[model samples]
Target: MGRNTRKRRTPPAAKAIAAAAALALGGGGLLWANFHASAHEPDQRAWGGNQTKAATAQVATVSCPDVGQRLTNVPDAARQGVARELAALDRQITEAYARLAATRDAQAKDPGFVRNAIVGPLGEKRAATIDRIRIVVQRAGGSFDNALEQLAPCATRSANQTNAGGGQQNGDGQQNGGQQNGGQQDNGGRQGGGIGGQAGNGPVAADFVDITKVAPNVQGKPRRTANASTGTFTTRCGVNANKNHNTDNVIVAPGVTNGAHHLHDYVGNQKVDAFANNQTLLQGGTSCRNGGDLSSYYWPVVRVQDGTRDFDQNADGGGKEGNVGRILTPVQAEIKYVGSPAAKVVAMPRFLRIITGDAKTTTNGLANANAHWSCTGFENKVQLTERYPICPQGSKVVRSFAFQSCWDGRNTDSANHRTHVAFADPASGVCPNGFKAIPQLTMRLVYAVPPPVIRNGQVMNAYAVDGFPEQLHKPATDHDDFISVTRNGLANQIANCLNRGQNCA
Candidate 1:
């Protein structure tokens, strides 16, 4: 009676309302709820702010999150204002060096003149000094390629102008405007007229190699962090519960394991027979799985010290400890006083580098992928115990800016260039012993990216990353290894991933 009494006669409006309610009930509230949730929740742009702010925030929020994100382009409203200013500064620095060098060379002929010129640009010869300055100025002018590329979407295009031919001019020091010079001078002791040498160029001619000069056109910029955990599996080495923990006993046996007793893969035939009992566990034997039983699974443990503390698992009863050994995040490792750079950048001082790393293969045919991901004896953790690869002689610092380049082994064209656009954590780290930790910093390099070029009807751009370690180019067998820090191993992974699909990110 209570329910049906009012339904004696449905008004036309009431009947329509009932029909709509029936339709909605048939579908349930899922569609409406979803729509409502989506509408209520902020849109991506609203949540993330904007693209430019988002990138800068990624780096700044993590370590130096509060830092400002200056547009890669020069902030000047005037035409080529930033470029002109950069070129001029470059010329000044270059002329300073050239004048000093020329005076030093002319000492025998005119010691008095040389001495006076050292203080200030002296007479007629000031032209060459000025020319050298011009070269630097030009290089500086063209070095805004990264900034320009970043600003392209917002840039107003003119019919007569093009983005091509903006790189540092060879020999002439005057970039883009078409002055002539021998070739761009690199800081590797090779003379050149440019505002600033590449950040990752090693310190000397002996360390130089034909490195790729352009940045790649993959991602706009690099993401600071990834989900990838930096640890790999290693079998227990010989016991060294003493002062000097040498890892000659630890060999790549035949099994892979996480911190737990679970085994994932085999370690292969590469055996480390240096210890008393030489045995390789294959296919997850009971002992290999349950290493808690030392008689079954005895992994030699070593204590690596970080700062004042030791990387001790403190496993009172040890076979293998979980991932509890205080691994340093990339942020922590690179945020300290690495060291002062021998050079400066953008009027600011930078720290020196200690160890550098890259993706190139060693004599062992072990690339970064194998070193970090393979089940064989090749691994970053193991290789570090064997040797500490630092900067070669003549390199201003052990580490340099990590550049971005093409994944194709040796194919670098204008379209694809490397970039040093990442200002994430100012610090970089290396595997000192069996684990990756931050090494003490010594110096830093300041590099500028050249503007892009137009060839065959396509416009191209270039950028730079750090840690070139050009010393690897030396013919000596010792020169063939990649630097072990600054995520060179990661670089190889990046190279490998890009080779697979250029989606390594």
Candidate 2:
């Protein structure tokens, strides 16, 4: 197959790096929208200026079809095996992307370098991995879809968005921060002055925007009917101040190490990792104030692009994978379970897993992009999906997630990880016909980050969610995950509290 062009149609923020990670991460479709920035003229501060245009404009990232989305069903027996193969695909993209980022110099000199070296070899790896997934399903007596093979080939995305005379810049006018004066400056933990940062990956200036400039984006809330479950159950989970962090994902890639390819700050259950199963999680200690709620809540840690390093700076899932800088611990982590406005709520089944946002939204379209990004003071005024909010000095950055509340009432998990649960209709507040409405878990995380500044094109002190190297650290890739391990008694208590319109903690 030949290269296919994908033009970004989203806002000015950078596009995605990998679609594969959404398997355990998040969901959305893939459509490259060509968002060309033709305004920024030549700037001497940038490298090589017009001399570097051709190579930079033609190639930006590796875009492959999301193979995991093709599987509508997989036998429960083969789900784990299939998940492993899918994760293999995700790893392939990451390795290829890291290489592409490292070879920027060579790519500039040879236009064919990325295609012939990175994308070509990556497709071969994906093909082999896809084949293994097919075998896993077939062995479990599940029908193998031929369409899976079509996802094997991924193309290099072009970057027509680069600023003119901005050799190392991001989109027009907006610059990427890394090493500034044609040399890499070791900014303690972050490399100053380039968009490619210390690891040659993201959180570019293109990813941030002044919060006040954004229009009001709060969606209309559903009307509360008389049948609405009006009560709430709040659980106090320490903000992972205990530093429970890992790169594993138990729900999607059980038993696989480094499954998330990014470090996650964990709260509630203390023993949730790639190898932990339902039994271990149930036995695990929790950080929640309510001992009855042993549920686990986790999300990728956000990092500030400063000149310092964390312990994992040189490790595979850390700086080596383009996730650098000091991790930001949320000052506030609030967890609440509320009743649906459409109907009285039921107890959530134990071991239910739910993901709230698409970590691959930059590559995955906005269909399932539910990241609620804003500042503490302006949260009700705006909600961002594609750009990181540049909060005012007094306001802190905020990341909020409202987990899906409608359940199929049978399976606690699904092959795609999303089909088992769904969000209530935003307008009507109703579950799909056969699905039951369960108590919805909502989380709000607040972080105090230095305001990043973009001057003459370069960005400073940028912050971003840690994600797959290929996902490029775009705010659009922000997301969260959860697993309910609440005891039956506590689960019933939540339901009763909500049904009675009482708030309990």
Candidate 3:
């Protein structure tokens, strides 16, 4: 059960495709623009003028390199310091973005204003932080170079540059869906759309799609082998009606306050925060009906943009971070661990951490995106990733996560916190070589949300998942987190129940 004994391997494809990309870091979410590069739009310096300058060429968000994702090899000795510095880098971007918003008038007056005033200064700050990270990484016998400084230059994402999620806005101020890149809402904003629910980031008219308009998007199930593990086990965790909410991310930015910059609704283990560790969590209380299942389960809060406010409205991760509106408590939060179609699942190591979906997917691209959005009655239809589905009056909204079910059978975690676990092959249900199938944690969150109105081509009473300010509350940024703390051989019981084809709750 010791985590350190597990040998880890980063799949070759994981490396070949994951070059640094750009991300938008803004308000309450400790959204680390930790410097990611973007293949879609490289660092953009707002240039050129247009008749609809305010709504078109305006600098929309701050784009920084994803430096944190690149540091997958940081030594344990240097990891804590590196994480703090990376979080620092994220905050720096947030501050710069605030400055960018504050100086919109100045930006309008001079095309060079944002470059001179905001982006330039942010790059300097990031270079300093990146240097500190390099020092710790190198001191710990890890290889790091000044070349990472190349990622320090943050850029401005003009409105046009940011609207690539779907087709362009037409006369009706709506966007046509795109099959190549997922569709998104644009709302073809009015001039000075900089301030909305918070910072006017998005949930634009284009972001919402009528469920009836979408074609069926369900894919065939993966093929199962004769020897596959054929059972499932369920754990009943209440739908977080207890309102255990926070903006801290204990896994990604442990010990760093307000690391997520967005509020998260937590169920299962009660003692998770920016500082939670294995010891503290093991001793923590759980909300699950089963006493032995003390796993931590959480996802960003879903907020209805109805001009309402909550306790954190003035606080960091709440309204201050652009995640405003009334928080929706799901009527149901279903948690299940099911056997892999390929083989029997093994027990998860105690304290194993897993994250599904990408919180910064709006800016980070669809590479790691795993959002599944649908409506109650339309569940068999296509699930959306970028666009929020506007269910009919009788239908409700559903957000779900199918977490990686394959484990490396060694370490409980990795430097980036992802490689230790992975999803099986989409077609074959087989784990990658050297990996073992583990019970997949499939969660479904059902909410009784009122459909947003699309009157006059504008989306009203919108709903969105809390995310980094720059991510604009796009549905693609939806994610879920978990930390297994099974006690008294509960994990073995889970595996046994699953392999034997029993549904033990």
Candidate 4:
């Protein structure tokens, strides 16, 4: 797929790297490095500093590392060493940008503070970190520049400085920040009073935003209609009634602890976690209705909060919220495979994992395009807002996700957990020309939320998904991860059923 032309505000991988680096290196080390650098330089531009003209712009080309090939071919010992060094560099880069943001935030209180205390030092430290990372990559027999490129969140060249007014002009000549618009940093930096800053930027009430009513046609396309004629098979993964407080099992970003941020409702396999291997998952007990089927289906725990309460009040020891408190289990979980009736689905590669939904919704509006939210019994009434929906008295709130179903004939995963497989065409809903058709895995989670209460003529729902307390629970935040742990028998069952156009419930 062609990369999106717009620059991402903050890359998810970068944030994860920064967070993991912070946890590994004590905050004191980061503070000392920034402080020392800032004390020496008084005038150079900050990292990603504003620039006035495109003519004067200097383009920096960072090459993307062949991460997929590197991981597949490198010796275990060498890979481990590279990973450690990369983590250290990630910490330094994160701290540099953080210090830069702090200085920028202080501009209103103290004039010239950003230039004297932050700009030069931040740029120096960031450059040093990039250089160190390059050396590490070279030592591991990989391209140093490629490592830097991989760390960058966007495809565009990094802007050296912002315009005089603090707004940076993009290739199209649009100013991204400054006084005209709020002086929000475009690169995922803190936006004053924006959703990126805190979770409670909106009203505290547990009310549905009624996205269908508010922006009825915000989503240009009609909601995807179900194709009943398509062959399908389902795995009965029982509901996880008990609260799963396990913060370690998430496979989204390996090596990062509690990467999910919010609590997860686990089903299928009981032992799937960050460190789980195929062998471990195969041997692990399952929560599925069928004992032989051991696939893992997990997603963020949804909670019903009263209008006056917040979901993160009982956060875990790491100060990460949504791990504790009275968690609500889905009424049931529907895990199924759907595919073209004419095609045969080959057995899915073992331990294949897939993720859907945009984790960084605040800055990326297009990220939520694939996210689907609707009320049961009123399936056509789809809403794209991330908050809990106001279902009718007898209806249930639903969160549904459809995973890509076309495989490249080999490779279980790509660097981004996608790309190894691609989504079928929207019009035909069939695998593209070279890729083989696989059973499209879809998950539908039903939440029995309370009916809305009228508050000032607005219908308020009773709860929301347990997301970062600082971020308002929006539909853009809706994400799901799936890891296939099925042994050959179950995988074959899906293939056989789908090819025969048999519906296996």
Model 2 residue 439 CA deviation (Å) reads 0.6
The 0-to-1 C-alpha lDDT of every candidate, in the order given, reads 0.20, 0.70, 0.70, 0.48
Tens digits of per-residue lDDT for model 3, 307-386: 56667766787766567777899999999999988888898889899999987655455567799999998888679987
Rank by TM-score (best first): 3, 2, 4, 1
> How high is the lDDT of residue 349 in model 4?
75
Worst 10-residue lDDT window for candidate 4 reads 26-35
On residues 280-371, what C-alpha lDDT tens digit does candidate 1 reach at each position?
31212221122321211111221111112223233211111111111211110011112111111111111111111222121111111111
Considering lDDT, which of the candidate structures 1 and 2 is the better prediction for this target? 2
User: Taking the tens digit of each residue's C-alpha lDDT, what string does model 2 give over 13-108?
Assistant: 111233333222322212111112123423211211111111122335456666666676999999999989988877777766656644555666
TM-score of 1: 0.19
Indicate whether candidate 3 or candidate 4 has the larger lDDT: 3
List ranges where model 3 is wrong by over 4 Å. 1-57, 164-198
TM-score of each: 0.19, 0.83, 0.85, 0.64
What TM-score should be assigned to candidate 3?
0.85
Per model, how many backbone clashes are there?
A: 60, 21, 27, 16
**If the candidates were sorted by their lDDT against the true structure, best first, what order would they fall in?**
3, 2, 4, 1
Error of 4 at 271 (Å): 0.8
Which structure among the candidates has the greatest lDDT? 3
> Which has the higher lDDT value, candidate number 1 or candidate number 3?
3
